[model samples]
Target: MKKVNQFASSKHILALAAIAAGIALPPQAVMASQITHVVQQAGAVKGTVVDSKGEPIIGATIKVKGDAKNGTITDLDGNFTLNVKPGTEIEISYIGYKNQVVKAGSSPIKVMMQDDSQSLNEVVVVGFGTQKKVNLTGSVGLATSKDIESRPVGSAVQALQGVVPGLNIDTGNYGGDLNASKSISIRGTGTLDSNQSKGDPLILIDGMEGDLNAINPQDIESISVLKDAAASSIYGSRAPFGVILVTTKSGKAGRVQVNYNTNLRWNTPLNMPDMMNSHQYATFFDQAEFNGSGNHLYGDEERKKIWDYMTGASDVFVEEGSGGKWNYDHTYANIDWLNQYFKHNSFSQEHNASISGGSDKVTFYASGNYLSQGGFLRYGTDNSERFNFTGKINAKLSKYVTVGYNARWTRKNYSRPTTVTGDNFYSHVLRRARPVRAMYDPNGYLMSDINYIDAL
Candidate 1:
């Protein structure tokens, strides 16, 4: 036992003698032997670093802090196996990719990275956030209001036609439906029924939910189409069809100035329908006779009287004594049924005025518009009337507070028409009738229900 104690004492003496001689150990050794210490921690989560194409970049240089033990290159396939404590910061860089710095999250990470080429050019809007467009891996379409300003459409939504590659605007039946546009689909027909499947894209007006038609073409700024799932996932199920982001004009940082604009427009039909001939009408009438769904029927003499009355050929047949042809007159000849519904000329007048100014604390713009239109169709039916007003205000109350206000009102009306000829009412003063139609007695009343057509 005494010998063992003497050996331990000799080793302690040797260690002390060596330390006193200024013999220094490695870094870790330098700190513990009555020395101060410096250490670095890893902030990165393992396997989170990925390439711009979303593929792992093997052998990529990865380092966090000055700790050599915490720094290493990625493995083959761009995959990295790393271990970092929470709050650690890791910077990953590759030969062809941009350097990425990421802090360790509570759980594992799945980082979607971009290459140097795209990292600098691409961008993505994640959550309520936005990144470079070149950085995104999903599909999307974007355009400016100028791209569609040249076309004449009732609603602003229709302006998107052809701007986005995936969208389709179908034939519209609601003639001059100025308040709304034709149907639009971004992801193709979603269901078996093409008519029903072409749902509208979720439209956002200046960050708010609303119809696109409410804004005038002059007020639009930009439009972005979220066509892919990832590009629209942030909106959830509300975006099953797709999403349309619309940005409106806002006040800019400049001296206050008032602006004025005026517009005058004239419209003419691009196509005209074929006219009906008296001989054909006389023949086809008997062949394709509506047979009048009603019990009323007019005989040839009555038809002749009515036709004469319509043409003003025979001192005008009176309803009482006129056993005349109801629609045989040449007046039907001059009446182009197709063109009858529309006007020979339409006039549209528009005017707008606004003032905007702002500074470091606040900026705002206000504008008003007036529009008048005279329709082509007859009044009390198939007519048009509209008057609208809108106001908006935006202000920054303080360093941390902001507010905005908006209001709009519109008064509108449409006329209706009644016709026994059904669609023929659109343009024609004539209707095809069965030979039996002439049998109906006068008084514009049907002798048999067979000659009248149901109202569409």
Candidate 2:
């Protein structure tokens, strides 16, 4: 019995030993298998990033699929090496180029990214946010600063003429007055109310109500015209005619830059009226007087007096019965009232300067402009001067928050003849001055008694 019992005990001990060995070997073997599996799944991916033209694209980003945190940039040779799992997908991207995806495998992967020119991906400014241009369904016209930079105009509104279809701009009174602005109408007249106070399109400059002429053309970055209701309805009652959105230039995060521009212009009248001279005037008056009165009013006496005055034969004399004994010698005078009062050509000049720069956290832009415009009038002081200044600063407070401030100041000065009323100096006062009247007496001093020509 003792022998049997000892055999049983030895068997039990052998079984226990076998079980222990199995447990110890399995843990080590399982660990080694897991390490081999991990090593086999991981591999080095080598590839080159090229453009559609097969040109190497340096600085292109390569990211493993489903692992945005793991990425590398292409080197100078457009080559990249990444440690990724086999059969994993990698995405490649670059600026102005389309994104591409390739599976990581044993073979060297070559990624070719094409240019993305589709408007669907292009971001455009909308009401309060940005949207893709392709997603827009309303009628919108965009004009960049480069589009109107070459135009030499005093007002920014003039630069928009003929730039966009369905937008009508009329500057019929341009140069007539200093503060005159171009009349803008989108898709024809919006209202039939004959009142001049209404029917003008709304102009918004950087989210504020402002005049289009108030902003300098040099400071304009972009102008978007919302022509349809779908695009303009955001402004509610203020946009019955249409909406003009003006965005000024902003400083970029880069090196500081200074820019200066000047424009010189000359203007000449397209047409001038032909007026009757002294002889023609005298003859017409004599005929009219004779027709009115049955007898010849001036007869030979008056006719001879007019001929002698024009031919420098005698000085004009008013008898004591008329007003007083006033002698006016206009013998050698054949003055052109129009030419004396109006200049043949007028001059205008505009100068602008700007300073812009920025860092990652803050940016600033400042600009100033001066414009001087001369009028067609020569006798009267007719001129205009304008000065404008603008400053803007933008700061990034956080990754998703930003703050900005913009301020603008404008001043305009206009001078015209004291006799001029409502821009009618030429049409009312100058044109009505009779040709027979003298601008100056024999002494060369201004003849204030010349009733018809005294305005000159």
Candidate 3:
């Protein structure tokens, strides 16, 4: 009993010492102190964000200075509420604006954000949406109107020939055909030859599967080429090779604006094959024939005649046939088939006009394009003409709903003489037409050959 009393007395002495040192408190008093601290931490901070112009900036972000998880965006009225401790710092930020940090001491705070001096980031169109270029991933090539507008090309695909990397544009045998379509591919033919590969990229204009040649180059606002499989997953099999997304220009909220652009261009063959003259042709032919059959196709007399004709020493170009008809002297001609059939220069022109306007509720954009191109043929009528028209309208019905309508029209016309093959006139001209043949007889009459007739 004495030992238990001695222990109780020691506990009392310790409590007295703690009270004298001001370190001991009652249980109820300690609970009250903790409750008061919890109440102070529960205080809410309300704030409104605005621009330097005093305009409410909706969607602005407000968060505790160092707490990314505790953040909220401003409402439509630029108001935000966040619960934070007294004297805690809060941050406000928005795109294209400078960030602001302030202390949370009072019930309401006003933050006026300043405009950031740096330029805004470029927005790139992705599979089914848009994203900033800095935030985009995967392989993509972007081209704007400035890259293609000034180019003198009939097809938009032609304008992008060397503009984008890994994008292959080929005119091939149809390079001289004014209205001919060009083939487009990406990343080459892969493991297969070009003739056997079906690797054409999918081209989309304003979300519609349209021909790239049909749309006017001037009407295009931007082109996004998605090259990787991950970037084009939304298109599925349609984009097995790649995807080309084209976005057209839209009206902005401003006064009515009109623009007109036109260009005239001349085209000339850069390098043509240096074909053999009559003398060289005879020498080579005789050598080839002798080498193959051990006999010359042309005798010495024929060689002499070819040399004389090439030297312009003989004017005998035609002779009378037995049936009272004139025949071109086959041995008295040395014609340059390429120079005789193709022009040195061709003329082409394009004109474009556009109008755009908008208000807060309604906006519209309309454009027209006209193109006329002439072929390289020196004879016969070879011409192509194209017209394009596009119009779009957008209306805001309410804060949440928007409606839009788009329309496009195009027309093309091309005229040329019949050829031995289907639209392969240039190749036939280069292959079938011989250098010894003349386009016209001595009497200025059309040649009797079917090739000459068809070419005319």
Candidate 4:
């Protein structure tokens, strides 16, 4: 009886052990089966995306929260079907629209997205970093490409004229001078210490010190003027006056795009002094000479000769000597030097071409510009030609790593009459050139000695 009882006990212990092992083994299999069943039972969530106006937003993206691999794009009808677990949150997003999150349920989802105006407000670049426009506490002026794109100007600084308050841009003598560049000052003068050289506003082009004229207007993306201490202090001593930050255009991720722009301009002098004609000028000179030297000082013959010459009555001049000698002839005499010195109209041209393209990992932008400007001077050579090239590239080396490269080259050729000194053609030549003397003698040779117009 004891042996039988011990056998029964041993059998019971073995059964219990087997039962425990079976329970443990089946749990994993059961859990896996349940997961598979849940996956198989995933519901199809159908939804349509539209804008605030209720217009369909095609190509909108529908994605599962935190799951990049599981996403679908809406079709032409703005309808999307995504298979997701019940009660899963799906995100709907479209460019220029606010994102929407909705739960997957029995009912079909309709998402109406509002326009995202936050992007329009934009974040402004500061000396230290970037800040939202609303959060900026300093005095800042902003100008985008749209403000300057329509005007055909050679220098980027010219586009900013009259656009910003308290910012004085002086483009001295823009009419006929192709080499003219703008001088900028913020809030009048920053310092009165003449010994320390008056401070000029600091200009930065794409974070590099560069001439504003060298930058092509078409290549500009935006410009920010940092005024006052709070806006510019981060740059230390360099910001004592003010700061002008220029941002250049970068490539966008999309299909390749090509752009060509050309502009032709004609310039005319607006303020030319009306000078006396040759006859009137000769009379004035004769009167002046009479006033300076007493009329009685010269002999009657000499006085008659001078009057005849000034009156343009006789072409021949005879001087008394051992042998009778004749000097100059001015028969067909009257000449308008002003008409010959200045051009009625001057023409200039500009051509620009750009190509931009990008992929998910790489982007590139390249542009070239040619500009030809004609000066108003009619005599000799006066013109300028400029060539510019800019290239930019960006690469996403890794998830958190990005590299960028930019290069720009510019060549400018300016030509003017060698007789003119230091761009003083108008001030020295035109203003002083007199109309009494003829540019050429009767024989068509250039006259070397003429009292009124000898400088030419």
**Candidate 1 lDDT, tens digit per residue, 1-456?**
566556545545654665688854333222222111111125435554576567765456667865657666653334444566777877777677667777767666565556557544544333355556766666667666577666554346667777778987764664453322467777677667766654667887767788765566556667777787874568887777777777666666679878787777886655555765333455455555546453323346656754664466864433332354454222222233344345676676766677777776667666666655555553333434554555666788888897877665655654455552235554333344322223234455433433222222
User: What are the per-model C-alpha RMSD values against the true structure?
Assistant: 19.0, 21.2, 16.8, 21.6
The whole-model C-alpha lDDT of candidate 3 against the native structure comes to 0.79
Regions more than 4 Å wrong, model 1:
1-132, 148-152, 177-181, 194-198, 286-335, 378-388, 397-401, 408-456
Best by lDDT: 3
Q: What is the C-alpha local distance difference test score of each model?
A: 0.56, 0.75, 0.79, 0.73
- Give every collision pair in model 4: none
Off by over 4 Å in 4: 1-120, 172-176, 191-196, 286-334, 423-432, 450-456
Ranked by lDDT, top first: 3, 2, 4, 1
Model 4, range 84-124, lDDT digits (tens) per residue?
Answer: 87799899888788889899987779999888888557878
Distance from true position, residue 164, model 2, in Å?
2.4
lDDT of 3 by residue, 1-456 (tens): 566556545545654566689864454323322222233234777778899999977667788988999877775446667788779999999988999999997768999999885433677788869977767777888888999986888889988889989999877665656766888888886437766766789898988898998999998999999888864578887888999999999888899999999999998887778878877887897899999999987788777777777788876544566567665444446878777777899999999999999999999999999999997877778789999999999999999999999999999999876662355655666676656666677778778653654566
Model 2: worst 10 consecutive residues (lDDT sum): 28-37
Off by over 4 Å in 3: 1-120, 190-197, 326-329, 420-429
Global local distance difference test of model 1 = 0.56
Q: Count the backbone clashes (under 3 Å) in each candidate.
A: 64, 0, 0, 0
Judged by whole-model lDDT over C-alpha atoms, candidate 4 comes out at 0.73
Residue 308 local lDDT, model 1: 65
Per-residue alpha-carbon lDDT of candidate 2 for residues 1-456, written as tens digits (9 for 90 to 100)? 566556545545654565577733233223322222233234777788888889977667788877899877775446677788788989998888778889888988888898887856656566665576778888788777987788987788888888878888776544455556678888987777747655777888898889987778899998888888865569888887888888899998999999999989998876588777666766786688888885654456656666677788987623222355234432224456777777899999999999999999999999999999998877757888989999999999999999999999999888876565454665666656666666766556676765435555
- Let me know the TM-score candidate 4 reaches against the reference structure: 0.64
Worst 10 residues of 4 by lDDT: 28-37
